[model samples]
Structure formats: structure tokens, C-alpha cells
Target chain A: MPSAPSDSLRLRVDVPDRVAPGDPVPITFRVHNVTDRTLTLYLMGRDIAFDVVVERTDGATVWRRLEGEVVQAILRLESLTPGEALVLEATWDQQSGAGSPVAPGEYRVRAELLTEGDPLLSPAAPLRIAPR
Target chain B: MKSMALSVRLLTAATVLVLAACQDAPQPLAPEVSAASVGADRASDALREVMALDRTVFGGQDAAGQLVIGVENAGVASGVRNVMERFGIAPSGYRIEITEPIHFATETLRTVHRPTRGGIQIHFSNYLCTLGFNVDHAGGRSFITNSHCTAQQGSIDGVAYYQPTSSTDPNPIAHEADDPAYFKGGECSRGKVCRYSDAARALYQTGIDSNAEIAKTTKGVNSGDLAVNGAFEVTSQDNSSTTFSGTVNKVGRTTGWTAGNVTDSCVTVNVSGSNIQLLCQTLVENASTQIVGSGDSGSPVFTTDGTNANLIGILWGGNSSGTLFVFSPFKAIQDELGTLNALTDGTGTGGSDGGGDGGGDCTPRGNSGNCH
Candidate 1:
């Protein structure tokens, strides 16, 4: 798993506790290179990818953010020196793969960074929506 | 009466608003620092200067997420700032802290002469350091400690080292043995690549019986009876023991035995005026008292499981307030010293235990039982 304080990497993600169905979901991650050498890591649109996953309490995947986007369209690389970190932020328009607003009910959602075939997933946070 | 009650409520609300405004407001948070300046560059610049300074200190991230340099004393602050200016870094970009000055007024742990880890101290011409791992290279028998311990300009051959006498004796048990067969010190663990450490080795006279254990005492700090199981195999294998979190321990001449957490693994630290990068370090902080003291230099750092122990690093120095203690990893010592014959008991062979390099194992000589 891509975790902070791994042999050479520290990946910490921040997910908000609550958000409306139609609002953009903000995702933030902090990546640190804890090794002694310089590191070239994938930033985006490549193997180093993040997924916004929404799942139900029954363990069913309700939605994925990168459902049909090009996985390799905007591949980016970030360089980090030892003890350096990068704070990357992105936002989701609260829409699912089907382009429909998610009906929230304490839905479990998280951010995952796929690195070196390891899925470093953030702790799932609750996205609540009132029946307005 | 209803109108009066309304008026009272309004007055109370107004008073609360006024009081709230009068309260000191917290300053806005600083903007996020860029990754390179705050991360690698700052860390890299912190290494050599800290080590050269010979003051025990570590580089850490401030709340602003920028690299802040911490020193052990005020004397080191100006020297560090001089280095900072070389990098075009402003004074505000760093922090100077004065922790306790280690290697000062000292006390004896136990009477020397035992195969124990404590009570044995290394003495230079005018300085003294606590002895660390009893190691040998090739066939020359020697011991390992911080490079700054024997900062002799030339050969330290035949330099006298000391051990405390007994509990009641005013004199030391062993004093003035100059057998400096070979000595090497490291100012930087890794030059510009990554983190490194400060280490030194001294080969002395043949008769003294030294072991791998640090002097165990029921005296200072985490004072108690303790044993060194073996060196951490970080130079050979990356195990759970070398993680950045969790408890780490050490036994020193000045501080006796104390425990602290492995907070920062990869960081730059200040020693006197020089900076030395540490790939893995444990910030030694005592629970209630000072974790380290003067004459604690070269003390062996270890981790224990109530019975067994694993060697990690050696005592270098610490801050005055005991807020920070810095150590050199066994792996770094091995990297600079080449082959070190670790002294387990008086019977140790002092051969290279593969000193924690890339999943290696210790030789049969390791007395701590497990090598990995």
C-alpha cells in the first residue's frame, strides 16, 4: 500500500466528513519522499492514479470517478527529494460514472493512489445527504 | 418586565460580542511551502553543517511545513545561520533551539572491568566519550562511537581511554590507554544524495576486555539493568524495528539507560556547526527527565522485548532541555567503517555482522541470538 512512512514514501490523504450530493467533492493528498535520494514519481494520468470510490454498506460499488476517462491521457511525473512532500488537490463534481448525482446515505467514499501495483487507499469518509 | 428581560438579553449578547472581539485573534496560517524548498533542499542543507558543528540536533518540519533546523545549544545557532545564508535561506526559514549540552559534568555508572555495556568510556586528549559497540576490523580490535568523539586532527594512535573505577573509589578503574591503531570519522552520512550519519572507530591496546553491550546501570535516566541483543539488521534487512515510529532505547555513560521514540527516520541534524543527514534516527526523549547527558557520547542505542535486545544506533548528543536526542544508525556505521567486529560478550569475534544492509544476516558471532 502507498502509505506515508513506507520505505521511501509517505502518502496521507484528507477526505471531508460530509458533503452535499450536487457539490464538488474535494480530495487532498500529501506525498512525502522519506528516502535519502531523489525520487521521480507519477503525478497523474498514469500508473500513479487516484480513484474516488463510493461504496454501500453491503460492499457494493455504487460509483467510481474514473469510470470512462483516459487512464494515460495526461501522465505526469513529480520529483521529490528526500524529506520533501507534495500536496495535491482535486475535486469531484459529486457525479458518478453514470454522470448522475450520488444519492448519499452515509456512503463510504475514499481516495486511492495506485503506485507500483499497490493500492494506497485513504481512509473512507462518510458522505451524507439529507432527504431534502 | 418582558421589555426589561429583552433589554437584558440584548445587553448580554452585546457584551459577548465585545468580549469576543477583544480576545486575541489567532494569526492566519501561512501559505503552503513548495515541495523542493521545504522538502529536499532544506533537508540536504541541514546535514553537513549539523555534523560539523558537533552539536547534537535534528532537522524537522515546522508548522508552516518548511524545514526548520534545531540545534542543541545557542552557541551552535550562529554557526548554523551562517550555513543557512550560504544557501540563501533567510533566518526566518529556520529555527534555532538550545537543548542541553551533552558531554559535560559526568558521573560513573558502575565499576569498570566487567563485560557489561556501561561504565566504559572513551577518552581523547582533552575530551571523553562513552564507548559504543566493541567492534574489530580485519584483526585489529577496536570500538565504535560517534566520529565526533575522537575528533583528533591526526592519528589518535595511543590516545588514552577511560573506565570508571568502582562504586567507592575516587579514581577510575582504567585510564590512559593509547592504542589508536586506526580511526575514521564521518561528517556526512550521504554527501548530497540522501541522509547519512556521523560515526567513528578507534583501535586501542589489546588487553582490555570490552563487549558489545552498553554499560547497564540502575543509575540515571531509564536507569536499570539492560543487555544488547544484537545490532538492528537495517543494513541488511528493513524490518519493523527500524520504523519511524515506536519506542527505541539506549544506555549511555552519562544518562545511563533511557528510552525514546523513533520520530524522524530521514532527516538532517546539526552537530556543533555542521549538518549530518540521518537516514534513520530515533529522537531520544525521556518520559520525565533528560534523556541523555554529557559523557553519553558513543552510547549504544537498542530496542528490547523485555528480555532480548536489538542494536540500532549509538548515542551522539542531545539538546539541553532533553527535548531531542540524536543517534547514528548501525547501518550508517557499517557503511562508513566497512567491516566492524561487534563485541557481544568479552568473547565476541568483532566480525562484520553485515550491519543491517539490504536483507543481510549477522554472522554466528552475534551473541544476541537472532541476527535478523
Candidate 2:
């Protein structure tokens, strides 16, 4: 994923409001270029610029998609035309960062576009992990 | 951190405008011309002189989207014409107005719970600012921020500091502890209050948790109560005025985390409003867009080596055009506070904690707590 000036871009995070225990939670991050002209963005290469983090209700982070993964050091420029939307998808297996099964509870999921400037952030979407 | 004495003297725009505006001339439409479009050779020279007078003076635009040069008073209004005439610039091409002095006075994606650290938003009275770094002060917990953000800029008035924003009033997390007074005369020129840095330290209330680690990205939602993802560790510092040329990252509340290059180091900035002048300030140009905004003062400035960071300074002011900003280095900050060190990763051991100053005579702590 590529990152640009946050004010010129809009980010949205989509997650299921409720999911049964042990079910794979699919998270979608969509970035739209709302400006009138094409914008050049900084790419961290290899989808490393995008991250999905799930946190407990107390604001404690439980799982982050990029945790412990070595991100490539390469940075390149990519262009996104106006009105175009970029989407990235990831699945959280309901596991904590330490590889333990996450407890059935309420959590919030958010996405980030890590750029050289302030990272463009998406509102945290609420999700409930309950045993059906 | 190496220390260097700054000797550059800069004249304030108010003084120059007063000198140029003494005479009256033909009235011209509020100088509405762009300096960039002011012709080729001669206009460029005039633009250079205008910039040399003061970078902050002629770089902003007014509401109508026209380039505006701010003057100190209506009398100084004619000074704009005088400058245009002296430099052979056409008065028909530019706009000028009698405007008040630019001020660095103003958010929150920086709210956090207990165990606060650097780069988070802090509120006092009706203003907001960023916490520069958590430090070990007098065997207690303290944080660094801009003096202007305090109840008073030149004196410690025991002002209470709230986290996130002013909505959490009456429940202050810290109180003003150390802030050096601004002096006039001697090293400072006449008619101005001078200070080595616009920095002040606040002692955290008892039981208020904190760490030396600065915030970065990885976890958090929008601008509301951002979850901690503190990864920055201050391994070293640059307190010298030898003109730095490298990438520095600023984790400010308004602009979250932004990177830029040091455009000017150890330059003197004459903050116009109250005749206050800051000495040995570092100026940065944002890499892409506007980075600094209101309420971002005291934001942590540092250089990172992938995982670890070298603490640089605290942001204080930006020009009307937010592309450029100014900060005071750690040397000036320490010159006022005396032998301080950044407490990183909750470890009290100076320098070894990877976020503290090693050579200070102050006693280091032992594991302050979880920075994240």
C-alpha cells in the first residue's frame, strides 16, 4: 500500500461487528484519493505500509498484522489518480500477539497508512468476539 | 550532546517596517502579487532581499488567495510601497496589509491514559501542546514542553497540565516545576526579551505513570484516545549549533508523525507578538506538505536509525506558512534546567536505557515502568 498526505486522502476500516469465537475475522482497509489531480505516494514496498491492529476495550493492543515481521527497507513512489480507491485485506485468527487464543470480548480494529509524515489513520471499527 | 554559542543577530520585521514606513507614497491596492511571479532577474533579487529581511514576513497568503506581506502597523503600510519602489518592484503586482505579529499559539489524536510519554498532546488552561520527552527531574517524574504553554512563559506559576485536551480540567496530571526566565540586555539586544530556549519542565503528579519512550504508529483509531505504540528510544542527542543536515522526525499531536530536513540550525527567531526573541533555534522544512500546526509546540524532534532514535529538541514555532518550523535544542533546554536526561523505556539507568543522556550528574532511576 502507498501513503500520501493524509488530508488529501480518506481511509476507511471495515470489520464485522460480531464474530463467533475461533472464526477468522476478515479486515478490509480502503483508501480513497478525493483530490482532483493524481497524487504521488510513498510506498514502503511489499504491502508493509498497511497495518491492521486489534485492541481490547481498554486500549491495549492485542494483535497487529505486522508485528514481528521484518518490513522491507525499500521506499518507492506510486501515483493514485483522483477518485481511485485502493483496498487491502487481511485476516485475524483471533490470536493475541503472543500466539495465545484471544479471549471472547469486545475489541476495536483500526488501520494505518505508515508514511514519512504522520501516518494516515482510519477510525477504529468495533468488533465483538462472542461464542455463538 | 555538543554545545555551541550562537552569535547570529536578526532584526525583527517590526523594526524594519517602522524604518521604511515613515514616508507616505501613492496608495496601491493591498499589495496582492506573488513573489514568485515578480518578473525574472530584478524581481528575484527583490524577493531575495525580502526573504533575507525575514522569511516569515512575506510568505503567507491572505483570504482572497493573494500573496500578502504582513506589516506592523498602518504607518508601516507605506513601507511595503517603499520596499517595492526601492527594489524596483511594481506596487500593482503585490498586496500588503497592516497585520499583527505572527504567533505560535495553537489538537488532539494524542490523548492517552496513564503512563504518558513523549509526543502526546497535553493541555493547560485553554491551550494544547505536545509533551517533548519524559525526564528524570529531582528524583521524580517530569516532562518537557514549551514555556508559552505554561500559565506564564517566563515564570513558573504552578500551572496545572491536563492530558489530551482542556476538557479534563481541574484534574491536572502535572505542575510547572522549572522554567528559566527570559532576560533582556547583555546577550539580548535592546527592546526584546531573550531566552536560550522556549522550554519548561513540569513535575508529574504523584502516582501519574510515565516513560521516556516517544509515540509512533502501529495501533490506534482516528484522532481519539490513541493506543500506545511507543517504539522510539533516544540513544543519543545533538546539542550543537554546527548546522545539522539530516532527516528529523517529529511526533506532534496535530501532525502525528512527520519527517523533514533541517533547513536552518541555530538561527535566531524574533517572535513578534510580545517582543520575545528565541535564540539558537533550529528550523525544519516539511518533506512534503504542511507538518507543524497549532498546539504542536513542544513536540519531540529526533533522528531515528530504524529502531532507536537520537533526541534532538522540542518544537516551538512555525511560520505563517506551516512548511517551516523552529525548535530549541537540548543544550539550551539543559542550560536552563541543569543536568537532565531523558528517561527511556522506564529504566532509570542514564544512557543505557537507550533514551537517556549518559553524562549528566543526575542519578538515574531503575525501571520506571512500561512505556507502552
Candidate 3:
């Protein structure tokens, strides 16, 4: 079903503020239904509907969760009642899509829900990868 | 006097021997550095040098959480030599591999009821979806639909299924029986929830009439309504391997009967805007036509041999353009829900009543004989 509005759903991304080089970074994403009625949402198939992207301070994309992965061509319908939320978690071994480690520096991580119409984007959460 | 002199000499000799033993005693060894500590130190220094060399350089740890780094393949030799010479590190001191650079890319049914077979409107709390097919579960008649069609997923008796687009019906035709809970870890991708099928079963009330058939359209493959032109009896199911491919058909509430080619089999799909992911799902494509749409979430997918239909899966969702659709194979449903005795050979408890054409009286037709 087509979405009602972008405001009816909220997306949030969470990660540690700082981590030592070579440390595994745990990421958490939450999609909450903020509407009073149940909302049927079209989500990408595969286990990932949203993406957690890590970018350098200058806005160069360093790593993304959905990049380079083969996701099926199916849209899924998920209904969320009012006040319900889904928590998605992934641990980044600090490796980029190329299987290389991200350089230690100031970076930001954000999440995006691939919804119909405009995708809902969360604010960039600051992340600093410092040398241990 | 001679005896005293001999005793003093003996005592002096014993004292001399004791002094010699004390002088020969081993001293504590100096503190030594372990090979592991030295290697670790070198690895740390190498990591610092590598990160300083290029900001775009990706560095991280392996599954063992040990510090490791990846440099461009073309520069691996020089990079290794630079770190070794600069940090006095050996090749075994740290882990490294050739890695390419990462580039960012643009990311990319209805109801029904019963004596009621499949392809009819089914309702639950302000929503409409198609009933996929009817089955016999534990000696009782039941119907299947998408888990999202119910008020709650993964809960037994969580929602009631009704017919003809009404939740205010005096009695519900069926109550939810089983919709397996989504799981994480193991085979599921990191951070995503997964389920083998987007299917749920609803047990029919004691007197509700149903058959093991799906609605067929006489209008055309792509045209029809809630009206039933005929019925497709399910004779068997597709149990092929993960690469199974074929042209499949389905009848849903919004879009009646439509056919498409199986383009993908047993692929992991991420449901957009949700954390749930369906694993090993079938994808069908009809580039020339839109086969499924909203309110058609639970349509039964099958293939017919002119006389009987072979069950394949249940339509859950598709691409927004409707060109691509996905279904959960019956094999997956059975694997999760155990045995679901779907009526084949045209045998059912209430007997076939040819089913109604949306405009007919759908009152419980109790054993009123076969309507085939």
C-alpha cells in the first residue's frame, strides 16, 4: 500500500560516539509507527529495507549496509500499529564494502528507510574512529 | 692440643665450602619481552602508519577481533614493505589483504472468502487481503493468508478472518492458527529479522463451508472480479530445488487472475521501510503487465495443466510498479507450520459448491454435495 505521509513514520540510527581503530562498531536502527492507525508500508525485499551509511566528514561515502549486496526484486508490506517500532541491528567490523577497514577519522553514520515517495532519513550521528 | 687443631681446620673447611656455594648460586633472570607483545606493538605501529598514509584506507579487525588492515592490491607489496621497514614488523605481526575501493550506488491482494476457496476477499480489522488457499489442519478446515493480513503476526488466535470485506460479521469464518515468529542470528543477515514465509493459517468455524479450490477467471488471464467463472483445484505443489523457475498464475482481490514468469527463486528480500526480510522467496516478473497490487497480498500462486492446478506459493508483495511480485513457496510454509493438509484430488469436508460469484448467497452450505 502507498504510504500516508513521511511524518507518520520515524527513523533513527544509533552508534557509539567513538571507537578505537579495528573495534567493531555496533549500529542500531529503529522504525516507529507514529500514527494512530495501522500503516501498511512497502519495504524492500531481503532482510534489509533500510541502510546504515558511514560517510567521511567531507561527505565521501565510506561504507553502506546495502551497497554491493544482492537484494531480491520484491517489495514487502509491513504493518505497524501505533507506537510500535522495529529495531534493526548490525555490527560493522569497521570494514567498508570493499572489505577494507575504514581509516580512523571523524565520520558520520545515518540511516535511511527506503519507503515509497521520499525516503525517510535520520540525522547523521557523529562517529569518531580514533587510534587505540 | 692436636685434636683441637684438627677440629678448627675442619670447621674452617666447612665454612669455606658454604661460602663457595653461596657465590655459585644462580641470580634472577632479567625481565624478557614476549614475542606476542612485540608483535602486537609492531601491529599497532603498522596500523598507525597505514591510516596516516591514506584517509580513504579501510582498516578493521577480523572475526577474531584482531587488528587487521586492507590496502589496494596494486600497493600491497610497497605498503607491506613500508610498514615493515618503518615499524620493524614481520609479515606475521599483523593481518592484511588486498581490497577494492567502495563506491556508493543508488539504492533501489485481496480478499475473499469461502466454501470459499482462494482468490476471494478476506477482511481483518480495517484491511482487506486475498485468501490464498484452503487447507485441512488437524482435522479442521482452515484458510491461508499473509501474516501481515492479520492484526498480529506470530501469535495464535491473535486475529479473526472474515469474508466479503466486513469485520462486523456476527461470526468470523476463521481464527488465526499459526504465523511463525521472525528470527535473527544464524542464517538471517546481521540486524535483519527473517521468516521462511509470509503465510498464516486461520481455522474455520465449525459450520463455515469451504473447498480446496482457487477462483478462476473466464474473462481472461488478466481480467476478472470477485465473481467466480470457475475454480482451480489444487492437485499438487512445487517442491523443486532452490533454482525452481516457471510461469506462475494467481488470482487476487484487486487484480483477478494474472500470470508472470519466475525470475528469481529463493532470494533474500528486504521489505522496504520495515526491518523484516523474507528469505528464500520467489520473484515473478511480467514486464508487459502488472500482475499484483495493493490488497492482493495473499493471492494464491499456481500453475495449471488445463484440468488441475499445481500449487507453487502465496503472493505477498511486489515491486511498486507491479511488474515484479514475490511469493512464499508452499515448501517453506510447510517447513515452518508443519503439516498443512491442503485438499487435493478435489476432496473437502463441505464438498465443492462450485463457489459463489460474489452476488450469490454465501450462507454455510453444509454438506450439500459436490458443486463441481
Candidate 4:
């Protein structure tokens, strides 16, 4: 008989209460493995290549994946075993690469957790940033 | 008949000449009427000058006779003896009547009314509430008073008030680069930035003790008596101490210098006004020390010991109990003023505990134990 799959792959993200333009918005996520099996996960988002987010709270969803070249060597997290947790952090610069500056407003951040070979999106939590 | 007529004409001519001589010789001025009129005129003039003095000189009309006069610019008190000499009043000839230093009773009344150059009405609230005199220290940058009396942040003509607090390292905060020009004798305080009108300056000048000459003559002030260096005078001695025990003889700008007694010694008074709160301790057994009400925060406390009186404390604040009061020691005040270099000698050194000039030399008048 094959062993039962673990349902413990949980994800969490944290954001600041308020942010102003040109200010970095730091986003951190923690993934925990509840089962005895190993897990692999990847974090993807638009223009989200830095250790922190410095974007305006404009109502745009231009999600961009962060790359090693853009985030330097500071953007990597290895795999984790059962009963273990993997932490990944990134900074989103609002003024990076001369994109349209984000306007001041409330913003919601979405963090999706996935398992290797699995296409299902894990639980998502919403983080709100008040206008500065 | 012709000879007699000539003689009569000569007599008449002689009479006319005598009358002319009398008129030209300045007829001996009538002694009583002229003397009375001159005295009345002099008295009138003195009264007018006194009236013209700033009403705040000693807290208003209550201090009419108590306001000391000096020869300096105006508000400065030359010396007790010198003041007496100016009025032809002799300290030796008359008995000394030491009274409690004048203090205003409330902060609301301490506010001064003045007109600015711009024809704008500027209300000086914080500084006005804490105006009073004491020997200064602080390289002329600081003076001594109840720490609570000093504002955490004060302003004069929109300039930030500067003071040294334990929280600020290197102490004695300075104004910003764009701050307004510094005001000198026109207005001053240890705790807050006080403003003065032209009349206020004249009032201060009338009572200033710049040379410390009066300090030399002061006697019988105790270790913790409140002292000020501004306009004040000692008038007639009221033999009836019991009748006026708790009543203030002099009046000033705030509550009219009414009399009160040290209700408690070493009492603590907690004061809250203008969004500021502070606790101050009056002298030991100072229940009779004229615990300050509101505007009286900066009034000086003195005692009559010998031929002259001496300063003891600077009105600061009170404790929660309201029974206890607080004041700054004259010596400490002098040290602060000295730090400001405001003293004439530019010496930031603190004065002797004995009223800064051998004053406060009297034994406690009554057997009141620790009047707190």
C-alpha cells in the first residue's frame, strides 16, 4: 500500500501597514511541510524580483516573476523535508525599471503555494497596505 | 497849600516806587501756601509716576507701595537704602516691615496685553504664564526657577523656547538657524520664553536689581525663601500681623497681590495648565510662604529680618496634595542665570545659600515646625 500524502504544505505572507511611493515593500513567506515526504515549491510574481517590494499601491495586477539576474544571488531557497519549513523573502521596488509609478491606494497581495508535479493552488491569504 | 500838595505827590510817588520794588523783588513767596502747593504738586507728580509704572510691577494695585524703584533705566531696584534715599525716606529712622514676596495667584491673569508692530494681536500664553525674576545662570542662557515652570516647548514671537533638560545631551537647547532674534532684558525667564511690551520693559527697569547692590543690604531670608530681582518695595509696617496673616498686602497683574500664608511647609503642589503639568515643593513650613495660585507662579518669596529683606525661593509649582509647594533655591537660580551669563559680572557661579549676599540671616520668627 502506498503511504498517504501530507496535507501540511502551508504558506504565509507579511506586509506593512502603510507604504509610500519610492518606499520598499518587504514580503516574506514561510512554507511548512506537515507530512513525512519532501516538497519543492517556486515563488512567481510580476516585477517581484527584489528582496522587498517598493511599489505604489495602485490597483494594477502586473504580476512579474523575479529572476536571479534582477534580484542578484539573494533570491534562492532550497527544498525542505517533512516537518520542516522553507522561508523566502523579496523586495518590490516601486520605482524599478521605469515602469508606470503605482498610485497611492489599498493593495492586496496573493501568495500561492504549489507542490512539484501538482497544479493545484494552495490556500491564499490577503495582505492589505493602507495608503500613505 | 502848594507846598503840602508837593509833599503829597512825593509821598504818592514814593509809595508807587515801593510797590514796584516789591513786585520786581519777587515778593517773598507765601511760606505755607507755596510749601503746601509745592508739596502737593510733588506728591501728585510722584503719584503720577507711580501710576504710570507697569501695573504688573508687583501684580497690580496691590503692589502699589511695594514696588521698589531704582535709578537704572527704570524697572531696576537700585538698593533698599538707595530707594529710601530717593524718596527721602530713611530705613534707619523707620522700622523695617518684612513681608512675603508678592506672587500672582493664577496663570490666566498672567497673560499680558500688547500690540505688535504689524498691528496684529499676538497672544503670548505659555511664556506670559511663567514670567518672574530670579538671579540667573547659564552663561546668560539659563536662570533658576521651578523646573515645571519652564515649558517643554515654548515660543516668543513664534521663536522656539530654548532650555536645558536632562533628556537633551549637552543641555541648553539653542534656537534654529532661522529663529527670531534673541530678546534681552525686554523679556526673560528660566522655564519659558517670556515677552514684554515697551511698558513692560519700563516696568522691569523700575524694579531691576542689576548691580546686586540690594542683595548686599538684604538680611533675614531663610535657606528656602523665594527671591526675585524685579520691582518691589517695602512700605509701612502693619503692627497687626494677626489681622493680615493670610492676606497679601500688595497686588499685581494677575490676582492683585492679595495676602496668604504658608498653609503647609515642604508642601507639594501639582500644577496643570496650558497643557503642562509639574510638581513643585514649597519651602519647609512654607504654609505661610504664600503658596502660588496661578499667575503667581513666578513671584518671589522674601522675609524681613533686619533693616532689609532677602530673597528665598522662586515660585515653581505644587504637588498633587496642593498642600506642598515648590520653588527654586535662589542660589541654584543664580547658578542658572550665571550659566546664561545674564548676571552683571558674567559669572555663572551660584550665589551663597544665604540669599546670595549674606541675607536670610534671621532666626525663624515663630516656632512653626516644618510648615509643610
Model 1's chain A TM-score stands at: 0.67
Please give the DockQ score of every candidate, comma-separated. 0.01, 0.01, 0.03, 0.01
Candidate 3: Cα lDDT at B198: 78
Give the total clashing residue pairs for model 2.
Answer: 14
Q: Give the TM-scores of the predictions, in the order they appear.
A: 0.39, 0.46, 0.49, 0.25
The alpha-carbon lDDT assigned to residue B233 of candidate 2 equals 73
Candidate 4's displacement at residue B27, Å, is 30
Candidate 2's residue-wise lDDT over A1-132, tens digit each?
A: 234568888899999999999999999998889999898775432223467899999999999876633222122245789999888777899999999999999999999875534557899999999977
Return the lDDT, model 2, position B112: 48
Query: How much of the true contact map at the interface does candidate 4 reproduce, as a fraction?
Result: 0.00
Error of 3 at B295 (Å): 0.9
Q: Using DockQ as the measure, which candidate wins?
A: 3
Stretches > 4 Å off in candidate 1: A1-132, B1-110, B116-119, B151-158, B165-195, B219-243, B274-280, B346-372
Quote the positional error of residue B289 for candidate 3 in Å: 1.0
Q: Against the true structure, candidate 4 has what lDDT?
A: 0.29
Q: lDDT tens digits, residues A1-132, model 3? A: 466477888878899999999999999989889889998875543344567899999999888876743233333457789999878887788998788987889999998775533457888999999976
lDDT of 1 at B301: 74
Candidate 3 lDDT, B176-254, residue by residue in tens: 7666666765677765667778787776767787777887765668663444566888878665544457788998876
TM-score of the candidate numbered 1? 0.39
* lDDT of candidate 4 over B150-243, digit per residue (tens): 2222211222222111122222122111111112222232232221100000011111222221121111122222222222332212211211
